[model samples]
Target: HISALKKGRFWITPDPYHKDDNIQIGREVKISCQVEAIPSEELTFSWFKNGRPLRSSERMVITQTDPDVSPGTTNLDIIDLKFTDFGTYTCVASLKGGGISDISIDVNISSSTVPPNLTVPQEKSPLVTREGDTIELQCQVTGKPKPIILWSRADKEVAMPDGAMQTESYDGILRIVNVSREMTGTYRCQTSQYNGFNVKPRDALVQLIVQYPPAVEPTFLEIRQGQGRSITMSCRVLRAYPTRVLTYEWRLGGKLLRTGQFDVQDSTEYTVSSLSRDSYGVYNCNIINEAGAGRCSFLVT
Candidate 1:
């Protein structure tokens, strides 16, 4: 003879898991619940938020462990979380054997009240600039509650100079006196704001480039004569910026010769080797800079 097995409903104790402290915004977190019921038959689990039933969707899922092997364990998973999902979560499980289990989860989602905004003037150019040249740049940004602005160049923070002679118009403006090429480099601006327990820092970068006229003077001038008395005069230019195309004009008694009479090389140096009697007389060189032009005359006997 065989004895009949007893079947009865079993209760699963509530198991809740959540963070005790508040979490920061843009952070990922997990909330879990574990419960069990004896003789699990036709087990069904439902999740709720603050007494409201949670609708089944791709964002939420409920699964139960194998009833024949690991009876009475259910899990609820939420993925790709967001700030709006923060609230109370309740897990309720029902079994056909008249058993039930309840679990509660308290979720605290961090909130950020301030937005990030930062701006830098001349964000595309180098820092150090040439003196006597106008520098144009801009800095403007938008954010919640605004943000404090700070500027720096070449790792050094820029601030208003302290002195009675310092003019008020220089505030918030980056200026360099007699700027040289050595002053060139990176420039950065940072903005930050604090809202309640949240703090955010944003930054903007700019390259400050200084432009100025050339400084170095022209080098030696020499005359090179090719085969068949084809004469070519050349001048060497040194340390010149904003390179210009050079032009050569041959003169007989100060009268300009025709272009067909001689050939002139492009700027950096002027050369006219194809010399005839028309290419000889008195010659003069004209050099132009960003500021103005200078003229030097040489006599060709």
Candidate 2:
């Protein structure tokens, strides 16, 4: 005859990541729970916040180390500390074998009221890109009361990703799709309120450079010049990237008049000395860059 086995003893302890660290806004807080069980492999952990079940998210992370590495240890990491984060967190450890009772432990995390501080990553700012590309301008904020983030242009109103023309955005991230030259400028990230401790560092700046193909002004120009007189035909190249390695061409009567390359020039000009009747016809100025080409016509009468 064999006797039945007695139930095993189990308990849970609240663990703190560090004793010297204080709860503060914009700081990471981690609460750990350690469980003592007969068969640690059969242990399962669940986390809760303010009586509601909690899962891993961008700001909240739940992790449990392997039983071999750190047996029966689980961690709850809260990032970018906020006022609402001050609450009771419970960790429940259960056994799959069902021989022992479940163990539950609660840990309260609190923080002193703090003001908002905003900062943009240095490497992420001063964004440079060509046309037709999507970009994101991210600004991070930390405060006890969860400050609201707004994005806007320093010069004018902002155009959000949703096609809504607003002065500011509350989404924190300013996403611009199919970027164009018009969208190039200084953008300001501002917060709604201060954290009340005179923590007034509430704004940041981001520079955006949108480069595109050459754009020519006055697509068509008409001029009157008599025979035997000299004339100059020119076209202005609008703000374009890659100012170097630009190729310019002059055409007349379906024939190429002159071609040359330029390093830096706002406009390209073609001169005709002692103009003949053939030169009085239409003259075309074509400019080509890595982005694209721009063409303009001059009607020399």
Candidate 3:
């Protein structure tokens, strides 16, 4: 009787094992456990986490094998391994003869994908202006890792002077100091990122044309009486780029006078005819060019 009891009884009741030793986060893995017992007609299985009983609603599933042939094989599936599931797992089995067994398994999860992408946006080219005039140059870029931007002039990099350059990280804006003629040249914007394996390089070129205001203000501001009873005012603009457009206006007592004798010529010369005492208080010539506007005023007696 003692020999038969020993041969029919199984010592180990549960054996647990993990599908893989290492797994990445956000992936699926399986955990299996087996139990061997005599007279498996009344056998119960339970799973636990870190020595604590696990609930069925804890995203864990258990399946029982054939009870008549191999009642010891039970499988537990844990889908979608997460960082929080990196602890130990245990399986418990119970039989009718007060037989019980438990087994433990461990799981580890990690990351296995590359980083995010980085992008840079198009920037507006710098504008050209004359010396002593306020000039602003701006560049904008965008990226996931937040790319670093640099500004250069004439192939030489420029640094922010004392309270000269201002930067807005949220808006990705870069501003330069007061611009001068020496500051005019080919400006380039370079962007780079160190988070990726290869450094991403992007650049944009802008040409700055420094133009001076209409040089040599128009001269020859004179009023003369003609042979007939007509007054003529002649003005000439000397050495003006873009062939400045000239305009002549006559004022009396600080009030503009209406005259049908106003003339404007593209030959850098302006003349007005049929002028009388009413159009002889003050005469002024206005010269304009792409750079800026200039004026010359003279009093007529």
Candidate 4:
């Protein structure tokens, strides 16, 4: 069994009951062993207990991978530890063509282990920040065999700083630079075993809010109405940071005709009592918030 280091290799297990080789009976233990080797795809793994070759059973399993966690890594999982399970377990790795000497690790399991636990900072969700700012999302993970940390987007794929789009990241802290509106959403931090264990991993979530200027559009670009008929002109704010229109300015041609405050809605409407010669012109509605201002205009006849 590998020792639990705060920062080091990957080890995954579900509700591990011991730390290192000291495991309690009637519990589960997963030993993740990795070796440095080339042509990892051609490497195979074998397990032996007390010098006897071991095989997979209902309570025991062995798995090997080339690129999952690293190049040459394997996992030996023994469940429901009992007195009979106490012994020196050895893992042997050998290349298919027998190019290099076989590498092995011996783990003495007497019987106890700690399971992994994951948590996030309180009230850290809905993290509000402006665009172009850098942000870091973190998670607190603790376990006997410290689990691997994986960062991921709860709803979409994450964009890494290196321009690679991936569903998950191995780094413990997720740093996003020059943030954009597309980065707004929920981010999930979870305990990962990479490719080692097949048990359910613990997870937590935090949200990111990217604030920016508002974008607006006119409900009607152009309208034609007969004289003596009333008409309503409306402007819709497409998107904004503050999300509230503090001030609204209605201008006829180049002069401001009316001004008011709208605190409840993003959309505002102006009603022209009667369509007359003086009312027939280009009317503009400008909406202002703390972040920025946006305007929408329409022509009337």
Deviation in Å, model 4, residue 136 alpha carbon: 2.0
Candidate 1: tens digits of C-alpha lDDT, residues 1-301: 2211122111111112333223433333333333444444555566777678877567755566566654554544555456676666665655554534333433322343234455554443444345455554334555433434445553454432232222221122444455554444565555522211123346566666554443323332344444346544443334433345333333445565432211343333335555665555556544544543334454444
Candidate 2 residue-wise lDDT, 48-151, digit = tens: 99889998998988888777886677877787778888887888888777756677776656655345577888987788888899998878766554445667
RMSD of each: 21.2, 15.1, 23.5, 9.1
Tell me the tens digit of each residue's lDDT in model 4 across 30-122: 777776655655667788999999998888888776476565677778877678987877888777767467777676555333555777777
For model 2, the superposed segments whose C-alpha errors exceed 4 Å read 1-117, 130-134, 141-147, 154-171, 177-182, 191-202, 221-232, 238-247, 252-257, 261-266, 271-283, 288-291, 298-301
- Candidate 1 steric clashes: 15
Compared with the true structure, all predictions reach lDDT values of 0.44, 0.71, 0.47, 0.71
Error of 3 at 55 (Å): 42
Q: Residue 30 deviation, candidate 1, in Å?
A: 28
What is candidate 3's TM-score against the reference?
A: 0.37
List, residue by residue over 67-153, the lDDT tens digit for candidate 3. 666556555555666677756566666664553443233221124322223233333454656656664455455433334455555
Superposed model 4: Cα runs more than 4 Å off: 1-9, 12-28, 34-38, 41-113, 156-171, 195-198, 216-236, 248-260, 263-287, 293-301
lDDT of 2 at 271: 88
Q: What is the full ranking by lDDT, best candidate first?
A: 4, 2, 3, 1
Let me know the TM-score candidate 4 reaches against the reference structure: 0.53
